[model samples]
Target: MSPRLLLLCLLLMLPVAALASVALGAASLPFGEVWRDVVSHVTGGGRPAQITGIDDAIIWGSRVPRTLLAMVAGAGLAVAGAVLQTVVRNPLADPYVLGVTSGASLAAVAVLTLGPAGLLGPLHLGVPAAAFVGACATLALVVVLSRHQGTTAPVRLVLAGVALSYLLQGATSYLQLRARPDQLSGVLFWLLGSVAGAQWSDLGLPATLVVGCTAWLLLHGRSLNALAMGEETAAFLGVRVHALRLQLLAVSALLTAAVISVAGGISFVGLVVPHSVRLLIGSDHRALLPTTALAGALFLLLADLAARTVAAPMELPLGILTAVAGAPFFLWLLRRDRSAAGREV
Candidate 1:
């Protein structure tokens, strides 16, 4: 199928997925009622007379924000994954794989455990801010470690990321052990990833970053294509390879941090969505980026719906579902790459 057609199809599926996400939770409201409530609220017509305060609260307060957060976080993470694959020149690169998510999680967990009077309180850094700082620091460290006489090797990048990820995750585990009993559940839930506690206020920064950074990325699609070819090739093509790498890394880290700050540690949306989209629509960044974003939004919307509804009252963590789906795909990719290498040799 053509990229444009696939894009349109994804665009159409978004509302359907979103409506399902909002309507099919534990209570299972009727689709018509959900639609009416949505339209009423969006049109500024106040709550529908037929809709009770409880129903209105469920539709507008909890599910709506949660769905929107899932969409925003999914789009941001997918785009970040696509960018990282190009940046590291590896198919295996993603926020979770590269330790970016762990870095962010460690920072956010520290804040959650430490509370108002803790170390970061003096700096006045919230969870999101601390997570962003941690992501940037981790990405910088990985890049530095991956450098071999000034250029990054794909294997070295992956190795460095794996090492740092393990170390940071170990730190995160230690912090969890130190958390207060009441705080531990919240911390565990956050680490596992969920949009269950989403609110209107949580939507703003992630939405803005996803939109703005995506636009910025779209403008540089040709540069991304060049970089994907290789640093030597990209420089030969008149792309400023080093400067572009730094910019891409910074943007990707920003995107991951923004999403992780709010959505916790949802994994594999990045790895799964972009790669799937690339397989379907080819790798023209202009098309690939937008389509990946839409697909990511749709993928997470459905995943969130299943996370809440599949087990009914006992909601599953968003990360568990994603990891379950992504891990097997990761192994397949490794095997496929190895087979291809063998064929070439």
Candidate 2:
């Protein structure tokens, strides 16, 4: 199918995916009631003000926030992956390829376990604030390490990211080992990732960042296309290679930081979603980026639904589900690439 047709199909399926995510959970609601409840909530009418119940609370309070966060976070991460892959000219590139996820995870773990409690000092959003700071610090370090003669080298950038990721992961592991039993479980769960505690208020920052960054990226499609071809080609095409790389790296970091802050360290959305989309619709950047966002949103919405319902009342971690699904697909991708290279040789 063409990109346009595929896009339309995805657009049509999105509402169905969203409704399924909202309606199916530990305690499944009837589809009709789910529809009615949603309509009432949306229109602010059908249900009487005096009548309130657990169902309404579950639908509006828990499910809505969780669903929204999953969708937005997935979209943001997928777009970040697409941008990084093009920016670095690496098929393996994902949102975490620059150590952003590791950095964010380390900071979040520290705040959750180490108990400086007031690290952010009075703001009380310590975990997220610290995570964002860690992500930015990692990005800055990676950029600096990869720079030579005032330009970033893609190979150096990837290597620096790999080194930093390992370092940060080790630190986070050490912190987890030292954590109190009560804290250990939470830290482990956070590292594995979940959207169970999502709130309506938690949606703002990530949604804004994802939408804004996606729009900005959509505008830079041509530049990204040139960059994908090579730095020299991008420069010849009048793309400010260094500046564009900087801008993309910053945007991707911000995207990853925002999503990880809200959703913990959910994996594979960044790694798998973009590749799946690109397979369905060729890698044009313009089409690839937007469709990747939609596909990411749809994929995670369904994944979260499965996460909640797969074991019923006992929720599975979002990261675990994604990894379980993503790993095999990624392996297949590698094999396919290897086979193609072999054929060429």
Candidate 3:
């Protein structure tokens, strides 16, 4: 589909999906009621607590925040993935490929099961902060292991990521093993990932990160394209190859860490969305970055919508739905990769 038509369709779908997102949930709400509550709220309704209607509470307080989180997280992950694929020059590169999620999970599980009472500060930052730390930690380690002569070699980075991934996973498993049965469920959510607790307050940092990182990426698009041609070519083009790689890595790591902290390591969004967008829009980072962000947001908003109402009363983990949805796309990518390899051979 043409980008114009695709964007137009998505634009039309976003509000409808957003309204459907606000309207449908564990409690059935009439469209008129939802519309009224939403219209009033956005049009300067009273305090959230003063809304005085249960449906409105769910709409504004719970579902809207959750749905908005889904969008931010999805868009963040997708853009981060695209950046990684380009910076690493590895088609298979993804946000989670570097053990960042595992690191975040380990930190969150520790906070949930072992931290001092009320010791974990900042709900918006607590989990996400842990995730950011995890991502940065693994990223630093991977770079340390991978670097030689101030150059980042893709194979070493991947290997280091795999190694840290196993180590972090091991640590998380140990935490799960040690937790009380009642405490186990909390750990499970951290492990599986969720947007069960999204609020307006939670979105500020992430939104800033997404918009800022996106702008930075677009500004650096020419360098990114140069890098894509190969390290030698990028250097010849006067792109400070190492500095560029470090900046991209730092930005991508922070972006992924922020969302995974808030959204719980949503699977395949970063991996699948960028891959799909690249297939559709071509590999020009200038064009690819913005398009992926919008598409990713739309994809996850709908996924969160489905998560809330899929079974009703019982909530579905947003990550579960993303995986269920994105895994098939991943398989297709693998198949395509194999076909391309065979053709080359």
Candidate 4:
């Protein structure tokens, strides 16, 4: 199948997946009603008289925002993952490779375990704010550590990220251990990820960043293609490999940090979506990026739907469903790659 055909299929599937996400939650709204309500809301029409206030609230107040956030976050993470894989020349790389998730998770977990006041004194930073700060700080640290002779080496970036991730994750574990029984659930939920409390206000920054960064990245697709070939080859092509690596790392990190702060640590969308799209579309960054974004949005919308409805009434975290699906795919990917390597040998 052509990449264009696959892209078209994904585009058509997205609205359907989004509709299912909004309509099939615990209360289970009818799709027709949900579609009508959504159309009315989007077109600035008054609410349908037949729709009750509670239904209006459910549609506009909860599911719509949640679904939109999932789409934005999913797209952001997927693009970030694709960029990271190219920057590092690592098939297994994902958005979390730079320790951004670890940093964000650690900060968010701290806020959950200890009250905001406990850590920040009178400043009282919320989990999202603190998480963003932590992610930026971690990115700065990694950049500094990875720099040698005034250039960032991909190997050093990976090593620094791994080291910092382990150290930060240890601290996060300690905080979780110290958390009260009542606090533990929130901590775990944040770590595992959820979009349960999404609001209209939450969508603006991430959606903006995702859109702007993705567009910027699309324009640089040629440079990314060169970088993926190898740093030496990219530099040989006059791509300014060092500057490009730094820019890609920064962009991908900031994008991942933005998504993680809003959506908590939703994993595997980054790892799974980009690779799946690559397998379908081939690795042209131009096509791969947008297709991955759409597939990711659809993927998370469905996963979130399952998270809320699979057990009904008891909502599972988004990460749980993603992990269940992604872990197996990851294992299969490893096995397949190993087999291919053996064949080459």
Angstrom error at residue 264, model 3 = 1.0
Model 1 per-residue lDDT tens digits across residues 1-345? 699999999989999888778888888788889899999999999899999899989999899999999999999999999998888888768887677898999988888998734635579678778888888889899889989998867678779999999999999999899998999998989898999989999999999999999999999999999888778898999998878887888899899998988889998899888887876677789899999999888888888888987788999999998878666865675566564435421
* Best-to-worst ranking by TM-score: 4, 2, 1, 3
Backbone clashes in model 2, listed as residue pairs = none
When 2 and 3 are scored with TM-score, the better candidate is 2
Candidate 4 ranges with C-alpha deviation above 4 Å: 120-122, 330-345
Per-prediction backbone clash count: 0, 0, 1, 0
Model 4 lDDT tens row, 1-345: 588999999889998888778887778678788888888999998578778889988998899999999999989999999999888787767767779899999988888888897656787988888888788888889999888998888888888998999999999999999999999999999999999999999888889999999999999999899888778888889898878888888888888888889899999898899887776667889889999889888888888888898788999999999999777876676576664335421
Give the per-residue Cα lDDT of candidate 1 at 32. Answer: 89
lDDT of 2 by residue, 123-231 (tens): 5557777888888888999999888897788989999999999999999999989889999878978888888999998899999999999999999998888898889
Task: For model 3, state the Cα shift of residue 42 in Å.
Answer: 1.5
The root-mean-square deviation over C-alpha atoms between each candidate and the true structure, in angstroms, is 2.7, 2.3, 3.1, 2.0
TM-scores, one per candidate: 0.91, 0.93, 0.91, 0.94
Give stretches of model 2 more than 4 Å off. 46-51, 116-125, 330-345
- Per-residue lDDT tens digits for candidate 3, residues 272-338, read 8887876665677888888889888888888787776777778788788888988887678657666
Error of 4 at 84 (Å): 0.7
Q: Return the clash pairs for model 3, or none.
A: 128-261
